[model samples]
Target: MDIRQLARGTVPWDRLERVATILARRYDRDAVRVEFLAADNWLSIPCIVDDEWFVKIVTKQHTRVHALLTAGRNAGALSSGSGGFFTRFETPLAMVEHEYEATQRMREIGCNAPEPIEAFEANGLGVLVLEYLPAFESVDDLDATRVRALAPELFATLATMHDNGLAHGDLRAENLLVADGDLYFIDATKVLPDRQAAARAYDLACALAILEPRVGVRSAVAAASEQYAAEDLLDARDFLDFVRLRPDHRFDSTRLRSELEKWAALSEG
Candidate 1:
């Protein structure tokens, strides 16, 4: 199936909710929220079960298409210039299984990650339900002051996770949440198995990039650096060279890189 073609428009609510019956068995039908997420290449939908839990469905088609697209980036799915599109479809049951396992692994290793409540197939679609963190707030909602205040704890969470040999590959600001004075990491699909320092730093850098615009590069870096040893900490500078080259990040790279270079020089002095 051509996931790109199929995802062109909003999918029919009824067509997508063939799995609602499964949800109704666990949650009130009236309270359930079926949201078809946008901007993703996959059929990503979540059934918000009245703020109690979330039933996340990642279709087999998306899982396969996503893999093909990744391979296409190098092999060229259709044509070298096409930047091509390769799609695949699989049994829905297999789609959510990997994520479910990953989440459990993170939780097992003591990271504040979500745990699976259930994993099953519904009407040929793969679904994994999880414990919803209703009180958590996205990093996007945080201001410079809030970010600075919590920077230490945030850094500690990443550092500790890194020290333990697990990496949260998707540490986007939104994926990091604060609730009740602690941090919670979500979206565990990309958790890496090795304890490579570079991978850990990459996660820290991802969060810092998102925070840079909000807290200013120096303040953001300062707050985060305070918690970890600068000797071998996850240096945002390393990732900056490549990350800032992207269009969205270019505008701030010069200023951020300058501040970082100054910081490095001053620390050395």
Candidate 2:
């Protein structure tokens, strides 16, 4: 991946015009409108066709420290940006390709992820086209009981993926979309190689953290523990104890590790 070869600027009016042409050909003109969503260091023109689908042309800027910090934080990486900085570790083409491969693998394992349509590379730039998750809404829209009911199933799906050799770099509610009662993952730029137990535990903990604030802390912990144990990612008793000591008595890495160790012990037994 040539980090230096990243594409920038949407100065070329043809790209926008091309997108408009494509959308107008496919859908009702009344249903579609092209807007310059952002035109700063990066450009995004959204061709929204009614409420069903949106075609977003995302152009990348040179990797900035602030952007990397934000992305790292979102990915649950170490929080202190003061001690270090992020480099252009991967090319846009490579990142898109990695995501495409991961999406394909997830689909094969029956884990719901956005369909990869096409990834275009031109003039040292890349753009990924994915299935628009129109009906999809964030998990934040749901109440406690709904989140509780959803956790085990979500965890099970993630577990299936991890068990079959895959890892998601960002496992957060916003990145997850629910449509017609099915969860669909959107962002896939940072898929990792299999670390089944670690990945499952990490994702379960993150899910519990988000749910705990909305649901009762106890209920969130129980739901997380239930899924972790069901998947045999952790032991019930150890996870229960770990949960009790969680930062908010809910979910954290310390507790996650304890629970994972318990599961490892159980497996050994």
Worst 10 residues of 1 by lDDT: 77-86
- lDDT per residue (tens digit) for residues 104-198 in model 1: 76677666766688788776667888887768787767777887787777777777777767666546666778777667777643322432454
User: In TM-score terms, which candidate is top?
Assistant: 1
Per-candidate clash tally: 0, 0
What RMSD does each model have against the real structure? 6.0, 7.7
TM-score of each: 0.72, 0.64
Q: State how far residue 23 of model 2 sits from its true place (Å).
A: 7.5
What would the per-residue lDDT of candidate 2 be over residues 38-64, giving only the tens digit for each residue?
423222334444444444455445323
> How does each model score on lDDT?
0.61, 0.53
